[model samples]
Target: MTPVIELTEIERTFDADPPVRALKNVRLRVEKGEYLSIVGPSGSGKSTLLTTLGLLDRPDKGSYRLDGIETTELDDARRTALRGNRIGFVFQAFHLLAHRSAVDNVGLAELYQKGERRSRTQRAEAALQRVGLGHRTLFRPDRLSGGERQRVAIARALLGEPSLLLCDEPTGNLDKANTNAVLDLFDELRAQGVTLVVITHDEEVSMRADRRVRIDDGVLSDGSTSFQGSVLR
Candidate 1:
């Protein structure tokens, strides 16, 4: 079967005084509905890889295939549309609107959609309910706990029912209890068939994935363990 995401000979660079190569000929492929973690220390290019996959940043050289469609040459408008329809992203920061209610924060993401789909409130509410935040829909970010705010972020990411969910340090702000809760929710999402690519340095978090890939000094170690048919056991 064709992979849902494929990165071939990826190279990304930043123009420092001496050019900084963030990624160097990185190759990766994520299968459909697979939960995988990219583990790396600081400056290891994990975030760069994630952003490139999400199309938020373009690689200097490489071929990125999303759902079998190559996406290197698409214009900004087309890229944004593809991201909205096919990829969901959660960042380290909650990135929620401070003044908007939890439901409204999520509803706002639907505004960019092209067609008349579900009502904003309905879509937001359903997403919140899925993330175990149904009771906190009316609460604003300031009114919610740290974990609750992160759940709201997750809800917003889920609103699009994306083929690939990209999370960067998703549990960075939460306590241990909340981290476990969020990880459990991720397991549930995997069971229900959501392709997850999480960039994290946390050992506990990385262990939860079906496969663990370690990136050290911008190179993948031999630790790319794949669970071919294991249903996340």
Candidate 2:
């Protein structure tokens, strides 16, 4: 089976005075239904990689294939469309509209997608239910707790049934209890065959993945030798 996301010799450079390289020969492959995490500190190119994977930005060089489609050369419109249809994103910030209810927020995501809007309400409700937020469907962002709000965001991301769910610091804003709640939801989603690639700097977050990869100085390395600062795999 083809990987959901594939990057080969991916290089990204910024046009600063010194022309800094944000990514260097980064190669990664995420299979269907896999849960993978990429961990790195600030200035370690995690954000750059997230943008590239989400199709929000193009790499300066190399190939990025999304579900077998070559994305690097695709036009902006095509890339946007592809990203909308194939990828779902969750961020550190919930990014929920303040005035919209959980269901409304989730339903709105489907409006931009390429399918019939029929049963949108039902689908959105189901998504909320999937994230264990069925009771909060009518609740607005401000009324919900941090973890509840994040779960609502996850419901929105899952509205498209996306081939890949790309999350960045998904649990960063929550307290320990909420963080564990959100991560438990991620674990449940993984068990149900949702493909996820989470980018985080937290060791606890990275360790939850089936496999973890570390990124530093634009280089990517396997988890076997790096978790807990020892070779434990």
Best by lDDT: 2
Superposed Cα deviation of residue 25, candidate 2 (Å): 0.4
Candidate 1 local lDDT, 1-233, one digit each (tens): 77888888788889999888888777788899999998889998887888898999998887899998889989988899999888888888999999989999988778765434557789899999999999999999999988889899999988978889999999999999988888999999999999998899898899999987777656665355432212222
lDDT of each: 0.85, 0.90
Looking at model 2, residue 96 earns an lDDT score of 89
- Which regions in candidate 1 have their CA more than 4 angstroms from the true location? 115-118, 224-233
Worst 10 residues of 1 by lDDT: 224-233
Error of 2 at 203 (Å): 0.6
Clashing pairs in 1: none
